[model samples]
Target chain A: MTHLLEAKFKITYPEFSLDVDLNLPAKGVTVVFGPSGSGKSTLLRCLSGLERAPSGFLKLDDQVWQDEGIFIPIHQRKIGSVFQESRLFPHLNIQGNLLYGYQRTPLVERNLHLDEVVQVLGLGSLLKRYPEKLSGGERQRVAIGRALLTSPNLLLMDEPLASLDMQRKAEIIPFIKKIKDEFETPIIYVTHSMNEVLQLVETMVILNSGKVVNWGPVEEVFSDVQLRDAVGDGQLGAVLETTVSEHDDKFGLTRLDFMGQVLSVPKQNIPMGKKLRVHIHSKDVSLATAAPVGATSVLNILKAKVGKIGAIDPNGYSVDIELDAGRPILATITRKSLSNLNLQIGQPIFAHIKAIKMVHEMDT
Target chain B: MDIPSIDSGPIWLSLQLAGVTVGLLLVFATPVAWWLAHTRSRFRVVVEAVVALPLVLPPTVLGFYLLILLGPNGWVGGPVQALTGSVLSFSFTGLVFASMLYSLPFVVQPLHSAFESVGKIPMETAQSLGASRLDAFFTVISPLARRGYLTAIVLGFAHTLGEFGVVLMVGGNIPGKTKVISIEIYDRVEVMEYAQAHILSAGLLLFSFFVLVMVYTVNRRLPVQVT
Candidate 1:
């Protein structure tokens, strides 16, 4: 079932004001992608009814959380929020911490079993430990489990991975993905990291300075040059789901079937049938009018057709490419590259997607 | 130890004064400290300053003002007398009232800071988890702010136990009725009975010191740190 969460709210602070109207998809991971202080987290807070909007409306799964005179307190809203800082109660043991939210939901409203959450978060051994005894990653996992055990209608995550190391972040992505795909409840995931947005979500809401700059499907929004400007260098966009085919050792390459073509990347040891997450920052990419026969680069090039070119800023530009041999890749190049390649709208080109430059983060 | 007066036994009178003052201050100050720690009201600093006034004011100054208030023909004194058919001035009950005011901030400021340091996050998170405000206060804030309570109770008790000027002004050192330890020692000294004064003074010193040391040492063990 397609779900919808609509909100239009305004909050005023000492020197800043956040006024935004957001419409997020009901299922899968809908990412709120934006720059810092763009009211991304504030939007999440408004959705959960944590910060009441003086004059606004919010609806989640046909339930009105807040609209004019109608206001539902946070506990009554059934929206679970995971703050960036793991705000676990220090006095409670790990089991007590988890049960803190579990016991809150009415007996009639509880859905998932207690043992299942402990298993999912690998918390069976940590039940007796205090909050301070656990590491940062452990605390976050408990936080996730605590929210899940609450059986909320929706989960709101405000950059939960921002405080974690890369390895710990990778450890949690599969769990987040499982919640996104296996569960019916929709998730509003907020992040300033494009890699995170690309790795977990299918829908996107691009925000800038407390306003909705763009919102649409993940692929379409990432390709938008204006939105590309919203997400800066090295974090630019190209996302393709590729399945492992075989490792070509003679050429030191691993071949994958992506979209409609057989593409190759550096000798990745991923087993057969496993999928890989490919994120190519627009800046690290180069476009060519002809597929060069002899290139020193060993892997990760696709034959794509140029769709449209647009000016993202005064000095930079973005190009949309459809990789006929594989999945589509969105490449943002400079105005100079476009002119030098003599590329125009509707021109066919070879995208030199670099092997080492592309980022690969695994998910179950 | 045997002193005859219109009042009853010395030990009974001292107990009444200590009990009344400790109970009254603890009751009034808990809520006041909670509010001082929580409210973002613009007048909080002013209220803080006023609450702290008794701490620095000369004991006699505080006592003089309270004496006038509780004295017959004075505003509070007349109302209290008319309602209860008894005057508070120069009585054991009056000494407790005077001592409570003198020790108000000692019990309050530490508790307030303790509550403030406990923060709103844990309480708020607990409330969102469906714990009521009262439940959160007891289960979360109280456990985290345990040291504040220890500090407040000990300081309040010790401060009142050692009160001198205020007791002299309001309590009037009536033997067997209004003479708390500090005043007992003071009275002995005034009559040039140095040996008696030294004994009582040493006893008080040992008692308050032991109480404070035990409180602080035990409180140090439960220091709160969030993960």
Candidate 2:
């Protein structure tokens, strides 16, 4: 349960320089979220042993991949990676691509079986199709399957869904979660989308301008007022992990427990006891000066307190409010709402959020 | 004018020679082109210089050096003869060797550029999936660089068909053995058979056009993204 993934490096090229100090988990997914050109992909390259860091150590599960005097070549490192583009071999059919990695990993200590992988990835029907023959999402699924069959101790995915449309992105997320659920293999997922970060990862490493801005649990990291530098102004929000309380067939609603508030949304297929994380955008939330009865506008009412107010944008100011029960929430209202409700730092308020505003679907 | 009249024997022999030369060149050129694509060697310029030497050097000059290397007195010939139990001098084997070297530039340039245009992510992704170096080359790099390989094959075959000074020096135009179409055409013209020479030359011209058309057609079919 305890393992350390540490790296410190300074890379100087003609056009760019990357200098970073990173400490991430040796288990679960540590999402590297940042803006473009922030060196997120470059950082993963150092971990994969594809890029040499003259003076650093990359050790995962007792094996030192690179150190002061020794550098394990990329071929020797037991790391698997997926790029923005699904780099499946065009010459090979889906089965061939999957087997390409399976054959490379030795029989001893193989964590996954070929059949299980095909089933989990839903790739059984695709085994005969060529890489070019599959759609964008199906190709990415094959790419993920190909990487997982290798039984890598560490997985690095650089914007795995960047090229896909929103619908296609929604398609591959559950497959990724299946890997996380089944294996203890640490995954380093690089992405810029806040929705992806909230839905996909529990731990986060926020990177900006070739530096580690913050690193912690996904919930705490996003709730941090300083995280504005990591996630852009428009994207700042709190990440909350909640369970499916019940599904109301009568109302076609799924009730989720968020900060002791039984928030209800349109019914989804997610069965009971399924854990899901969702990002409630700050702008979608409305705070009231006093609790009221017989209001049809808001689907959720949670007792909260003003945590901290961030910089003001053109129209309104965004406030970090902690749900009195648990979890932090973001609510943006005009400066008029702040004074009208006498909303100040540490003031008690009721946050009203609508369930239909969920940006993405959650899975069990 | 009293020499053996050029016939299908020489034409077939030349075709066989060019065919074998191109086939061998392709097999060897694949790895070389791949290396040129992926290797970060400081001496890549040096290797590139050597490969391009055949392009710049006069065919007779290259053929003369090759003759000396494969001839009895040269170092390569002795070891080669020792290994094969026969001399390579002035034979079909010698002609193939000369043609491969003579036509190498044609194959290398096209394949090299093809591999370059293929970019590196696909190959790296394959290797990261635990594929061994060679496996990645064939499974990932080759498929991605296919256009380059085709370019290499067509250019190599056509270039071998067009060899002049090199074949004259190394192959020596033996009618039933080493003589190819170009050498056959040369022999016909030397003997004042303009009609036969014109027919063979026209065939060569048509062959070049056919191969060039194949290259252009395949390139257009490739997924070339225009900016």
Candidate 3:
């Protein structure tokens, strides 16, 4: 049987309010993406039972956590939550912190073992030290490990990397990915960083001004022109899931295959057949009416058909055009270029891809 | 100069009163301090001012009110007299009750600040990790606030040990019942026993200084020190 998570919440404060209704598959990582003050944290808190919405309904699979006149306390919700700060108990050593939740979870319900978690988070050496003794990255890893040890049915992370510097964030992303891959617990991660959304999100929920603007598969949502403001102008792009098909060691380039088309990027150390997420910014793509006959410096040129065209910027100068190569891709072009090329819906075209970034390497 | 022998009676009584007062105050003041630290109710400021009244009010003023309230025909004393067939005023129980009121702010304020410094995040994190509210308080908050507990215990004990005015008004200098060290010293001075008075006064001065030193030393250490 397929597992599903359903949630509906309406919470009001004096200045801000949060209203959302979401039914998402209880699998992988569902990222709640928004800018600051967009109620991302509030929504996560409601789901975790930390904040009680006066009117809300929530259920994970067959278990109902909250409904009309029925509210479960936070401790009874069986959720593991990690906040922006690594809220490790200062009094407890790393080993003790990790075991805190594990010990509280009933013996019959425990599934994730302490040793395996310690190994995955690379926490073996630091187990004897207290939270104050560890570096920021180490402390966050312990916090994540502490949450995971509870064997929760769902995990909620509210900007777990927000407090760390870029170097520390880079240090911890892999462990987060490992947890996503190894654990069966569905995760609801809240983040304001588009980079985090690209690197970790499988499903994306876009929150704007205390409301959910859009929610769907990450690739489709990223391609939506309506998300231009929420995701920032520079971040409007397409996410393509591709597999490593060939390695050209001589040219220091790697080839990825997606939908019978090949995209080459700077060489990656990942072995062949590994799946990767390639992020293509809309600004990097240019359109041509006919296939270029002569040699071009751009390595990737794919034949696609224009699917939709609409103005994304408020001034109507720049337009975001959706192109259907096999999977949908988005390109941002100026009005001068659109009229110069006379681009229209259903027009067959050639897309010149100037750059591509390999965002995440999926574990097969 | 020859050293005068100190009477052990008042010293033992003072120790016992301070011990019992500290013990009882810890239990009663903890919940009040926790509530003050975390509550958003408008009554918080009102309650805080009320708890702090003893700190600012004269001891005799508080004692006079306690004297009236705990006397034979007064509200508390009347109810107690009917139920237990004993008077509350001028008794050991009355002195203990007065000391608890007198030293309440010392115990509650340190604990309030400590609980405030510990903040809401750790408690929420603990609850999210499957610990109940009570369990989290014992496991996470208590350990984090140990310094505050230490300070509260020492201050409450020392403050109760030095009580004189409130005990005098309520307990009326009853020997072996409510005549604690401070009153004994006063009695010695009254009878021109300067040498004996000097001994008890000097002992109290040294003990208070030591307690203050311990509290300040702990507070000066790095807050996250292990244990």
Top candidate on TM-score is: 3
Candidate 1, residues B107-222: lDDT per residue as tens digits? 89888988888777777677666676787778787878878888887888777777788888988877777877776766667878777676666767888889988997887778
Q: Which CAPRI quality tier does the interface of model 2 achieve?
A: acceptable
Best by DockQ: 3
DockQ-based class of model 3: medium
* Per-residue error (Å), model 3, residue A308: 1.7
Candidate lDDT scores, in order, read: 0.77, 0.79, 0.89
Candidate 2, A1-364: lDDT as tens digits: 5457777877877776678877666667789998888889889899887788677776775788877888887866778888888878777788988888788888995787789889988998989977777899998888888888888888889999999999999899888888888766678999998767877776888888887888888877776666665677678767777778899999898888765667777787887877767777666678886888675667677788877776666444534444433777777677767667776777788887754344344544
| Candidate 2 local Cα displacement, residue A313, angstroms | 6.0
DockQ: which is higher, 1 or 2? 1
Q: What is the TM-score of chain B alone in each candidate?
A: 0.89, 0.91, 0.95
How many pairs of residues in model 2 come into backbone collision?
1
- Give the clash count for each candidate: 2, 1, 0
Local lDDT at A165 for model 3: 97
Per-residue error for A208 in candidate 2, Å, reads: 1.9
Error of 2 at A131 (Å): 2.4
Which candidate has the top score in lDDT? 3
